[model samples]
Target: MSCWDTIADYGLRSLGYGERLLPRSDFTLCQQVVLIGSGMLWNIYFGTLALIAGFVMATAVAMGKAARNPVIAKISAWFIFIFRGSPLFIQFFFAYFLFLSLKNAVPFFTVLTSAWAGALVVLFLNTAAYSGEIFYGALQSVPKGEAEAADAYGFGGWKKFRKITWPTMLRLAWPAYTNEAIFLFHATTLVFFSGFPAQSQRGDALYYANYFADKTFNPFVPYPVLAGYFILLTLVIIGLFGLINRRLNRHLPQERRSRMQMRMPVLR
Candidate 1:
């Protein structure tokens, strides 16, 4: 089939649209590109939803960690430690089984056994813990002068936090948070390796890439294509986050604004 035909046939195969059967032989470059690109939809789905939901949870957890109540603080601290301290791969394995057990016990959890729901939960919690720590650090680092200034203006409680503390904390945490966002997107690939199965042959970009690699016994082509897709995704994330970072620092002089520098963690 022509490239356009390949696109039409496999463009959304990962979402269970178009052709159901994967190409078995005489694999063309167009097929690999299109199918893998199709699978990227899942990665984007997992990353986008997880990151958005995780942000809200992270903010709350950060506040909890920094709360005056020792009970709240310790609970938040343990939550972060449990998620952050463990390898994500292990988390996925255990979560799948746990959800599977729950599904058997409670029909309501049936959906949670699927990769779409189960894997998303894992990613959500993982990112939240990491980001909660980042936000907590930023909260702690919020200049004491800022708090004093808020007190001087008679800004207290939620109002003060909304107008003064929260915005400043975000401004301080955004650079690190951007990196976390990038890493979260990258981590979506792990879903393919998780215990959660891709139902109906619908899987992520890495899934299709691995298929092509196994079929052709040529790892070079499909793997590099997968990498290329992720590289483009990383660029998009950086550009978007950079705009937000700039918005956060807009009130400050250009030289005084905190610039976002990409720092890949040596180990997660």
Candidate 2:
């Protein structure tokens, strides 16, 4: 088929549109690019939802870890320890089976065996733990002066946290959180490989790329294209996060504003 025809056929293939059957032989570059790009829809879907849900959950988790109440603190600490201590690949496998095992007892959980709900839940919780640690460390690092000032102004409890503490923690955490997001997006590639089956051949970019490589026994073409796609994806994430970082630190003087480094932050 012509390149345009190939594009048309596989462009939306990942979403169950156009060609249902992927190319079996004589794989073309256009076909690889088109199909893999289409498959990126899954990665974007998983990553976007996970990141959004994880952010809110992470905020709560950070607060829990920092709370004075021992029960809340221990619960949060255990959550962070469990998720952060374990490899995410293992988490996906364990979560899929755990969901499947409970499906009979909890009919609502039956859906968790699929990549849609099950995989999203795993990604959501996994990212939330990672992001929670970053936010927790940031919360602890919030300047002491700010806390005393809040007390002086009678800003106590949630008011102090809402008015002064939260913003500063976010400002400090933004850089590390950016890295966490990028990593989480990259982590989406692991779902199909873990226990979650891509029903209807609906999979992510890495899935299609892996298929092409396996079919042709040529890792050269498909893998590099996947890498390029991810590179572009990483750049876009950085750009979006950069905008947020600027806004987070916008109140600070220009000299005091910290520049975001591409490197990972020191989590401890």
Best by lDDT: 1
Pairs in steric clash, model 2? none
Per-model C-alpha lDDT, please?
0.93, 0.92
Candidate 1: give the clashing pairs.
none
The 10 consecutive residues of candidate 1 with the worst lDDT sum are 259-268
Best by TM-score: 1
Q: Model 1: number of clashes?
A: 0
Q: What is the C-alpha RMSD of each candidate to the true structure, in Å?
A: 0.9, 1.6
lDDT of model number 1 = 0.93
lDDT of 1 by residue, 1-268 (tens): 6899999999999989999899999999999999999999999999999999999999999999999999999999999999999999999999999998988889989998899999999999999999999999999999999999999999999999999999999998987888898889889999978899988889999999999999999999999999999999999999999999899889998898867877755436
Model 2, 1-268: lDDT tens digits are: 6999998888888888898898998889999999999989999999999999999999999999998999999999999999999988999999989998999898998888889889999899988999999999999999999999999989998899888999999998998899999999899999999999988887899999999999999999999999999999999999999999999889889998899988885432
Off by over 4 Å in 2: 265-268
Query: In candidate 1, how many Å is residue 167 off?
Result: 1.0
